[model samples]
Target: MKNIFTIVLLFATLSFYGQDKKISFLDLVGNNIQVPRGCEAQSVYELQACNGTSIKWDYYSTDMLNEVFNATISAFAEGNSSKTEVTFTSFGGQLKGYKFKMGTTFQYFLMGTIKDQPLMINLGTPKDITKSDDLDGFLSLFFDEVG
Candidate 1:
């Protein structure tokens, strides 16, 4: 019985460790965002948060981060007017994201260092995709901020 329990616990720990640091679609903006129509996940490039316990924000910079978001927005807007803003949280630190229109459809690019790694969210949009709840949820994952 002890052996069986130990094996089970070990497997559980290994499984959790294997999935240790990954940014899934949910980690992007939590709920209220989904895989939009007319497009599939073209590709995903993930920068792992850490091997052991570590902070996610130390890997990237504000200027480089904003460039990614702004460049995506500009591409979607096709050289039209586009804008982005930087936001910071005491716990989560700095991040950048934006919403824009491409031809007739909407797109979003939300990127930041949350969970102690760089996360870039790029996808088609849902109506009211610009939700404060999404941003708060994204940032709050790092900080112990309430409400």
Candidate 2:
């Protein structure tokens, strides 16, 4: 009888731990914001508050070729105004960033230091994309126009 009770208790504890966890980006926003598809949205506060062992933020933008071209006024521009793909990985207490270029221009760029990497975000046009490091911040600024 004692052995059976212990097995049952262990099973119950394991089952409870296996339940699915859901975290939505909308929960972090203070105002009404339409999060873009293929873009992972989360606030800095929410990220800090998370207790999960693994946390990540992935962002992407499409159908913005015209915007990219219009935003670029300099000759030294390297990125196109087409589709942008960005992925941010935060796992095991480390953050890494990667960017993928699509449409007319095809390329992949990695951000951060050679030894210790940081969050990687898509670099948009020359004028706007060049100045920002956090992709979420850039998206937040253009949320009104894009959303």
- In TM-score terms, which candidate is top? 1
Write down the lDDT that model 2 would get: 0.33
Task: Pick the lDDT winner.
Answer: 1
TM-score of each: 0.37, 0.29
The per-residue C-alpha lDDT of model 2 at residue 119 equals 25
Model 1: per-residue Cα lDDT over 18-66, one tens digit each: 8845233322323222222322322222222221111222234657766
Cα lDDT of candidate 1 equals: 0.44
- Lowest-scoring 10 consecutive residues by lDDT in candidate 2? 48-57
Q: Show pairs that collide, candidate 2.
A: 65-81, 68-81, 97-120
Candidate 2 C-alpha lDDT tens digits along 80-113: 4543433322222222223233433323232322
Query: Could you tell me the TM-score of candidate 1?
Result: 0.37
